[model samples]
Target: SQQGEEDPQALSIQEGENATMNCSYKTSINNLQWYRQNSGRGLVHLILIRSNEREKHSGRLRVTLDTSKKSSSLLITASRAADTASYFCATDDIYNQGGKLIFGQGTELSVKP
Candidate 1:
């Protein structure tokens, strides 16, 4: 599985500001998804936007995909301290049409009040 890179490896923002994390991949991909992980906890599925889809939304989470650039971005609006976590972008579980996801390093967000 190939891995992508995320920008702003670590981000510290205010409670109300918006946080944006970007991920760029290397090869072709079918689907792109974003997940959140709280400290000492399992990953929580946030949103999944297909390669064909340009943007998607789930509650306060917004995701955008740019196939031409092989990049995607996760935007969290009205951030809160509880939203402080590591966000990662992953590719479809289509390892040669198998079931395996390729994930990026991640963007560590720290929301402070």
Candidate 2:
């Protein structure tokens, strides 16, 4: 079951601006991943962090996870209209051995040009 709950169900920002999204989840997780989807299409993997890691970055994307708080956040810098998409956080339950990921409701981001 998806236990993660994303903040700001939707967001609107202008080009060159910065967008931030947050996610909170219940229970312990082995790893957490951030994904982006455009126009209801396939998910594009953004970044992933293991329980032992505090933060990870890829391109203009930055992800931070604090296991002690059971929360994580995604930050996008210099946003563009093309960056408009829905972002979701998935978690690999530590107790679930099947490797199933539980997803959050998602944060819809709109970057206006």
Candidate 3:
């Protein structure tokens, strides 16, 4: 069963603008991770936030997790056209064996130059 679902199915913005996406899940999770996929390519890991962590950042990417709310958000700062891609949130359910990740539907982001 799918654990996470992304919001705002799609988004578009100009270069240098920030992009924000959200994800909500159904159950307790060990960790939540964000990934980006370029057109016709595989997804790339962006960041991972543990259940105990409230927020994390790497480069221009910021991620926040609210376990109480079973939700998370990703923010990209000073976005570029190259940043255009589909973003997905994945969850590692605490009850699941083998630590499998259930991916969200994803949000398609388009950055116009």
Top-lDDT structure, candidate number = 2
Candidate 2 lDDT (Cα, 0 to 1): 0.94
Per-residue lDDT tens digits for candidate 1, residues 18-71, read 999999997788889899999858999899898789999998999999989999
Which portions of model 3 miss their true places by more than 4 Å? none
Q: Each candidate: RMSD to true structure?
A: 1.5, 1.1, 1.1
**TM-score of model 3 vs. true structure:** 0.95
Per-residue lDDT of candidate 3, residues 1-113 (tens digit): 67788998999999999999999999899899999999969989999999999999999999999999999999999999999999999998889734789999999999999
TM-score of each: 0.93, 0.95, 0.95
Candidate 1 — what's its lDDT? Answer: 0.89
The TM-score-based order of candidates, best leading, equals 2, 3, 1
Error of 1 at 84 (Å): 0.5
lDDT of each: 0.89, 0.94, 0.93
What's the true lDDT of residue 45 in model 3?
Answer: 91
Evaluated at residue 20, the lDDT of candidate 2 is 93
A best-first ranking of the candidates according to their lDDT comes to 2, 3, 1
Better model by lDDT: candidate 2 vs candidate 3: 2
- Per-residue lDDT of candidate 2, residues 1-113 (tens digit): 56999998999999999999999999898899999999999999889999899989899999999999999999999998999999999998899744888999999999999
